[model samples]
Target: MLTNKGTLIPIGGNEDKGIEDNEQYTLEFIDDGILFHVVREAGGTDANIVVIPTASSIPVEVGENYLEAFSTLGCKNVTVLDIRSKEDSEKQASINLIKAANCIMFSGGDQSKITNKIGGTEIHDIIKYRYKNEKGFVVAGTSAGAMMMSQEMIAGGSATESFIKGAVKMYKGLGLVPGLIIDTHFIKRGRFGRISEAVAQFPQLIGIGLAEDTGMIIKNKRCRVIGSGMVIIFDGRRLKHNRHKILTEGTPMSLTGMRTHILSNSDSFHIEKKKVKILPIEAPFI
Candidate 1:
């Protein structure tokens, strides 16, 4: 049982961008207006936010992007931690920044890079400790960052090839949250088959698919959907299937009795109870 009192924001890739008069990005991605939400959750504008761009190939560029975004959102003490190697992750200065941060944001990129470079380092340990012990600490990540928030993560696989047994590679992640697997770029990328197969493989874990521009805000036992798109839940707890016929390489596996739920913005889901509360729709009176 994981009991982290802090908040986790896992966003799908390619969030909507706010445009300026000069046809440039306003630095606000219309991630259901989540940048503001993050500010609020991290104890308002004076919050100390450290952005980690380790997952990105172009760390400097990605780091700048977040620095600008948070700055535009009026967050005063936002800084980017340019961690390239395990040594950088272990630095006392890096660890100090994490310890002082009200929020830690992981930028989108290759999740393996994040786990390899930062995992088990002093920075990672401090993050885990603060997230569990601090009341309002926040951990936010997008795309690959979002994918690595669980105990088990999708390393790589195309949706078309995922039906084949052992096609998708699963890897150990940050383990900030347990018993869950998160997949980003869900609807736009057509990742249903990929996430479905993941659930079939590990029926005990819940499979969550986050569509682009959408995300989930998870606390201890509940998650609230945020953004314009939807959150797909593939529950395999009641699943029934025959695996003997499909264990051979290249053969497509079959699964049955898996339950699924689609949640839109403002909807809430109870993690422990596996329950969903849909927000009431608004309509004009006749």
Candidate 2:
């Protein structure tokens, strides 16, 4: 097994150490928003992989130069989704790409742009179909890409005590992972307050804050922390007195019984069991 502190696990290797059986969805969280990499996370060896960078604002280069590195690693075939150039003409290309691959990767860019372009289109429909019907197709993304994986996504803004009508927004995510909200660049961006704001708004949900170069892999509803930085989990299922008499901007509030855990590389935490299980440093590969 190969591990990198901040970057993604190298592509094109024929190893199945950490992947789970019957796991059709491989979700990768990139250090940067909208930027991520995914190989065949499911199915037999030599699964086809497709990359979609529709969220990017700039033009993307496809073909040899674009996919040679990963293809050389082990990916049987690689294709890019250039949805911006010819929205109508490329529709078939996008659909064909999703239909042919066992893994799909969303590139980094604006979350809104990605969702707007591919969320309800034929390509999105095909991706959803493969995720549910296919046995081993995974959907992965980086920063913005990571945010799109959750049921609720952090639209924008910084950490602070102030509030705005739509300062923090929630949208329909891809729903590959449910009940959890993901935020990247956690520590480096000082986004705790923003996450806190989200928790305050939706007390029943779990807030996952991932530091730069850090990621959490979910299996059987349990999250395993990966990479060099830390994974901050805010569990507010037991919070009390959330309702305020006069709720307003910058008002003082107290949230009691909210649970938090600081997980380092290789540490595991269970959401439903409400327990944190630390793994041995020398544990064997999965």
Candidate 3:
């Protein structure tokens, strides 16, 4: 959507839920934390928030976690829409809730479950439509949910098989951001080789590797980093002497001149411009 007016917050797994009542963690939650940003972006505490836990195997528990998290943020109008199957996505009540939502947050789980259930349904279409046409609309996701935002999604991969031809597996995603391929828990999960192979396979698309408890707020082609960890950018647009294409499956591969950028909180990446705006050392914490 060239003129899309919505916002996408794709979080890496294990974001602070503000559940700990301890003083220090609570203070962290209050001051410019990731969820705080989400609430602020979705029109404050009064925003009509819908939590979709369809991707989780334990939807009930995950849904409740979000309800509590939002409550801690002083958000009262939160509803969990547990869409377990395709039939659930077609429910009129589900559709109504989605339409009324100022923001929709998808919980972490299996990305395939979300696409299998909601990909072609009315709920999915409504989200896409509202995201493109409505200003201030927000769609947020974590882990598997984050990975589903791109057109070419990485379903699963092995970090141990570094540079191997068949190291990563790809799948069709929700197409929310067609130009990106998102991978979560990158730092902790040791997924550099996974995303590295993915970028080599599709040199045209940019690969985003989000570390746990970290995320990016993307709008108007600008991806701004947030949270406590790092975001690795693998820009394969300028790759030279690529060997992945010539190698057979399971064969070790290599590439030269594949650009990489490691960023932390407050740094911004301009998707179309292929430029990075790093935060200065003296800037105040946002």
**CA deviation > 4 Å runs, candidate 1:** 16-31, 242-246, 283-286
Local lDDT at 197 for model 1: 76
Q: Which residue pairs in candidate 3 have backbone atoms (N, alpha carbon, C) closer than 3 angstroms, thus clashing?
A: none
Per residue, candidate 3 scores C-alpha lDDT tens digits across 1-286 of: 3857899999988644365633222222223488888898899999999999888887887787788778989998999998988999999999999999999998888899888899989999999998888888999998888999888899887888867899898888888888899999898889989998899989999999999878899988899999888999999999986788788999988888889999999999988888999999999657
**Candidate 1 lDDT, 166-282, residue by residue in tens:** 777788899887778999989988898888877877888899999977888888878888777889998999987748234886787888888999998888888788998888778
Q: What local lDDT does model 2 show for residue 203?
A: 70
Judged by whole-model lDDT over C-alpha atoms, candidate 1 comes out at: 0.82
Report the alpha-carbon TM-score of model 2 versus the true structure: 0.75
TM-score of 1: 0.92
Which of 2 and 3 is the better model by lDDT?
3
Model 2, span 59-159: residue lDDT tens:
25322223644554555566765666337423676677777877676655567676766666777666666655554566756567677776677777646
The numbered model that scores best in TM-score is: 3
Tell me the RMSD of model 3 versus the true structure: 3.4
lDDT of 3 at 55: 82
Residue 110 of model 2 has an lDDT of: 64
Alpha-carbon shift of residue 226 in model 1 (angstroms): 0.5
RMSD for each model, in Å, please?
3.5, 8.9, 3.4
